[model samples]
Target: MGVEGGLKCVKILLFLFNFIFWLCGLALIIVGILVQVSLHNTFMINDAAASGVPIVIIAVGVVIFFIAFFGCCGAWKENYCMITMFAILLSLIIIVEIGAAIAGYFFRNKLSAIVHDSLTEMITNYKNTTAEFRDSVDNLQKRLKCCGMNSSADWKGFASDGNTVPDSCCLNVSSNCGKGAMTDPTKIHQEGCRNALETLLKNNILWVIVAALVIASLQVMGIVFACMLMRGIRSGYEVM
Candidate 1:
């Protein structure tokens, strides 16, 4: 009776572990799906520059979740064939992660150089535009002086007159000025460059290292759990 009770306790523990694993795997899968959807939405709203990191994260999450789910199912069913399949899949995931980490380490400097070049070009363009706009504003302020009586008058008409100002300067000041005010071109460029660099580091190297370690550890745990399930299933079969 004591032996039977002890076996029952072990079986219950195995069942609980299998369920917990499955739940965590399913949650990760759902998170991956959501991340992918968000990435798509970001791309639609802006240029293609916004989609890289989320897509990479989704890919990693999906791979981990599917491998874990299969392992849990294999353990729960106590099927040697399923267990063997999951083991193979986990091994492949670990290898791929390791390869990614190695590639990222070697190419990191090149990636940084590309990001810096792009950012420098963008900043240069922004500085040129800003200087031109500031000069135009200074020139206009020097020419126009509206006192209390003339302040409420139509300065647009005066500004448009051929005798008062050049047609080129008067042409759509609001449109040009509004765009400059609404968008800090320099800041936008800097942010884009920073994001691109961060994506490479976080997704390619850091995440690969972390995921590889976790998956390797989990695979070891999986082997031990599979053995336990096998013993329990065989014992149960014999008892019946």
Candidate 2:
């Protein structure tokens, strides 16, 4: 009787774990979509590889959503086959997540160079870019209190005067404050935009890493519960 009661407890816990897991999967899907949109629309980061991270997260979430559903069904019905399949699928999901985490880590390390190059390209084509993009550039400078990609000197081609920078780089942002003030640290922000932008991207990547780790840990517990219930059912025990 004690053994039967223990199996019943495991069955209940497994069902409850899977229900929570389903909700976690749904949350990941929503978060992944939001992050992807923000990276493209808000930050204007058009890196193909950077954009692919969120899509992978979405795919994993979708698989997890269905897998958790199967797990719940298996636990409730005390079906050994379904439980076995759940364990297998959940293990695969964990493997995929580990791969993603590794890719994300390497991507984070290279993010600085990526942002530096992209911002340099934007700065070189400042006059040629669309008005909206120019506005984004100006806003980014003002918000980050930065000048150009690496320094105010990067705008030498854009600013006909070698000493001039955009008013967006001004400390007070008054009209003409940036005129002939590229080297005036008191009047303009002399630092580059690259580091600030790179930091922003790295922070976002940190969030993804943390979320993946938390979800992976929870899935591990769910797997243990699933295996325990599977054992009970296979041993001719009624976990229900």
Candidate 1, residues 1-240, lDDT tens digits: the string is 665555445545544554554554454345445544432322111223333433443455567666666666665666657766765675675565455445445544454544445434323333345655434333322223211111212112333331232222332333233222212232111112244433533453444345445545555565565565566565564211
Residue-level lDDT for 133 in candidate 2: 78
Q: How close is candidate 1 to the true structure, as a TM-score?
A: 0.46
Q: What TM-score, over all chains together, does every model reach?
A: 0.46, 0.86
For each candidate in the order shown, give its overall lDDT on alpha carbons.
0.43, 0.85
Tell me the lDDT of model 1 at 131.
54
Question: How many clashing pairs does model 2 include?
Answer: 0
Candidate 1 — which residues are off by over 4 angstroms? Answer: 1-57, 120-208, 227-240
Error of 2 at 2 (Å): 1.4
Report the C-alpha lDDT of model 2 over 1-77, residue by residue, as the tens digit. 88999999999999999999899899778877876765665556678888777788889889999999999999998
| Model 1: worst 10 consecutive residues (lDDT sum) | 146-155
